[model samples]
Target: MPESCRSRELPASLLTNPEMVRACRARDFARVFRLVKVYAGIYPSMIARRCELTPSRVGEVMSGRRQLQHMDVIERIADGLRIPGHMLGLARRTWETPLALATDGRTTPQSVASDPVAPASLPGAEVDSILTLTSRTDPSPSMLQALRSSIEDYWRRDDQHGGEALRPAVLGQLRYVVGLLKENRPAAIRHGLYGVAAELARLTGWTYFDALQYNQARAYFTEALQLSKEIDDRQFMANVLACMSLQATYQEKPADALALVNAAQDEARAAPGTTPRVLSMLSLREAFAHASLGNRYATHASIGEAHRHFDQIQRGDTDPAWVTYFDEPKLIVDTGIAHGRLGEAATAEPLIAEALRRENSTNQRGRAFHAFWLARTQLGLGKLDQACQTATDALEPAASVASERVAGHLREFYDELAPHREEPVATAFESRLRVALPMRVSGSPRP
Candidate 1:
């Protein structure tokens, strides 16, 4: 073995962290070897020499063939490597258990640690058979259907409960589907899988963004955009770009947001017979970006474009599944908020009121968004009491759901009300607002 590969005294702390144990159990040999190598730089090799085995034994353990038989040998290895007794035991236990591939095709063993159940329904059987077959053959129609059904199940769970309950499962399913798609090289499967991947990435990004993990969200969105491009689905690409723009705007990067919106607009223009809803959505993103940059004229121009696009969209036009929720009234509400941000209270107030009224007949998630933005507009107009009430209303549904955008709007509304707390209207608003909004341990509104 090379001198650099020699083991040395390490810290007990390394073994305690579950991530490290997982790394070892998964046979991440390079990582384990590299960690020991790094430790050698800080400690002398004499401590390692005291152990019966050399650095090569550590390598053997990581490579999964070495059976640790003696307690003294394990102890000396732990002592030399500075791994804690309990953690060393855990590492040994993990090593003994055969590492199983997760359903997602990741090398990590399934955390649930239960026996596999047989497929129950036709769909389940189809998925099982496809997964088994794809281990050898190309993806078939049954495989595509199974994958699509799984994706649909994720959506159904999200719609019925909320993203919080479904996100982890959805992410695992996405990884599994991607693995299957990669393993089987059929064109149809690839195309379907790309669409599914883009959607999953978009959802994952949105979920992480809600959790205030911006970097993680951006990584997912970046992957989503790349997948959208691969499928040549202009509408999906535009939507993904719009989502990226929203993330940028929220992060206070207005210029980057505008750039994304512009790119999306170009993509929409190139798309054949694009639906009005999609065009309006792209325009809405552009308007928001312009408003964030304090470009009132550009914002208004974009708002107008948004309305024009919404007007042109026919009722029965084919739209992407993701965008089907948006309609003419929804487009109007979105444009109205853009106007509100541009300081057009006269034009915004009635539109906001109409949106709130329409929301009563809409989905919970959409209603929450409508309420949030309306509250924002109300705050802008110095209608503190109404703003607070609207904000409280918005938060009611949002608290039960897993949407970052809705929660963010509510937070912004709270921030806008912060400076005027002494005023009677603001005071009244604050009393109720504080109770409705989720707060951190520091008693500050959650971002």
Candidate 2:
């Protein structure tokens, strides 16, 4: 091997470097190329040859004139440069988890059987890639259990701080789980692996959705549906469809959203494991679609149906891990959101306020989101001072979260308050926005 491309193995120190870590996490290959030159003596030419990219294209990426997005290209880069797959949101590379020896420095059969994964591959809050952990090697029940725990932790963190930083890690885990699905397994293990992949895909879709990247969101949601369908997990399929419907709702496609919810309610209900919480969520989504379309009566009917389902909840009923977040507080919040969307601010105001009081304050994004809705509800009822105050209170929580969706809601409320811009309350809110959400709030009104 030429010295410039010398064996492709990056120094372990370089891999653990903070700058390189951030660049890899963000998939900022331009910076990665620069860092490689500084640390590993690999120039752009050698990179092009090793990664199978033309010199010109490599220069373009290194110069930040282009970005690499395709998964296949990413995989190639991971293999060629010897970057750990998890670093680039790909599956773990073959060389990463070599089954070389046991803790005692001997290749014991029992050790390989018991410890198929390196400690680095353990699933945690970071959702690290674990190809050697849950793949064809062992696929133990504990491995799957740990992944589920990691996913649940992700959900908690996402609710609290928003998911912008979580995207890469989640995708890495998702890729690893998808790789696990390729090997033949027992029926139960296959089913379980598919479910985990679907959940991860759904989560990736949500992070994209929260960032307002609807196209990327829809693609992941579709992938989630496909994975769920592969296992005939109708309930999970319904969940993924509902996620797509929510994206459509946000995109202002009420009809499309309605069609998705209708399919979920009609077909997914037949799944043996379907829970009342699932039905309640589907009904709420239907209400959102109807409310968005200004179908007031239909919206009310859907909300009523949602409540009917919510009341069916029993302590012993088996609910999927993902859907457990749709508890009473969230249900109330969604119903209030539906009413607010339908322009029934008076009805929404108290409901939103009560739900907020009941909601977990640790969930910063949720607090900020519901606060925006509550402000809108108050504004609709002609309570200008109250609305502004509510919006002002939301800024702290919103600042803690990194969600474009929350920022959009704040901007939306500001836009609606434009007519009353001259009022002292609106002006006060605008000043606060300029300070708290400097990027979201222009110093002046939108042109």
Best candidate, lDDT: 2
**Candidate 1 lDDT score at position 63:** 59
Candidate 1 residue pairs in backbone clash? none
**Model 1 lowest lDDT segment of ten:** 113-122
lDDT of 2: 0.84
Model 1 lDDT per residue over 1-447, tens place: 643344432445665455667544332434554565564443223323544344444444545534333445555555444454334322233322243442346566534222223233223434544644554546567876776677666665554345655655555555555655655476877888788778887887776675567886787788888888888888777887888898898888999999998998889889887888888888888998998888999998888888888878776888877786676677778778787767787788789778668653425666787787788777777777787777766656765666666666766766777787678876665566556543511255434
Reference-based TM-score of each model: 0.67, 0.73
**What's the C-alpha lDDT at position 207 in model 1?**
67
RMSD of each: 11.8, 13.4
